[model samples]
Target: MKTIITSALVLGLSLSFSVSAVADDDAMMQAAGKELFNKCSACHSLDSSKNAFGPDLSGVVGRKAASLPRFAYSEALQKSDITWTEANLRKWIAGNDQFVPGTRMRHVEITDKAEQDYLIAYLKTL
Candidate 1:
């Protein structure tokens, strides 16, 4: 009985540490993503209510493409059925042409998967 209780306690402590590590990793990733957004800040607004050249990205993680009421979206994006999941966002960032052909964002150059992951993480904060 004592051995079983000790093992359970060890397992619980290990799980706690694992969760904490994940939280730390997420925070670090978000920070890296924020730095990457400096390039995008020229066009995209992180504020939900503020639309810049691009629509505000607040709460975009699960949002439908071209759904922001205040901003004008390209016809292709407007017609798209995409829900902004992480995978879709990654593709959009790396190359919108491949993900959604005819997207107006034709010159975006980010292609590194790690960088995209960080940017997506930062975007999630908004």
Candidate 2:
């Protein structure tokens, strides 16, 4: 009985450490992503609903494409009928032109997959 109790305690401790490690990794990824967002700040606003050259990205993760009535979106985007799923966001970040032909956003493609992952992680927090 004592051996079984010890094994259970060990398992619990291992799971706790695993969870803590994952949380730490996620926080680090989000921090990296926030740093990457500096490149986008020139044309985008993340903290508020105010639109700049691009619509505000505060709640963009699950939002529909071209949904902001105030922001004049490209015709291609308006017609794309897209939901900003993580996969779609990844493709969009990689290359907006390829993702949506004639997209007005002049964003440079983020070619690094790791960078894209980091950016997505940060975006999810918003």
Best by lDDT: 2
lDDT of 2: 0.91
TM-score of each: 0.82, 0.91
Per-residue lDDT for 21-105 in model 1, tens only? 9999999999999999998888887666665788888889999999988777888898889999998888788878878888777
Q: Which candidate is the best by TM-score?
A: 2
The number of clashing residue pairs in each candidate reads 0, 0
TM-score of predicted structure 2: 0.91
Please list the C-alpha lDDT of all candidates, in the order they appear: 0.87, 0.91
**TM-score, predicted candidate 1 vs. hidden true structure:** 0.82
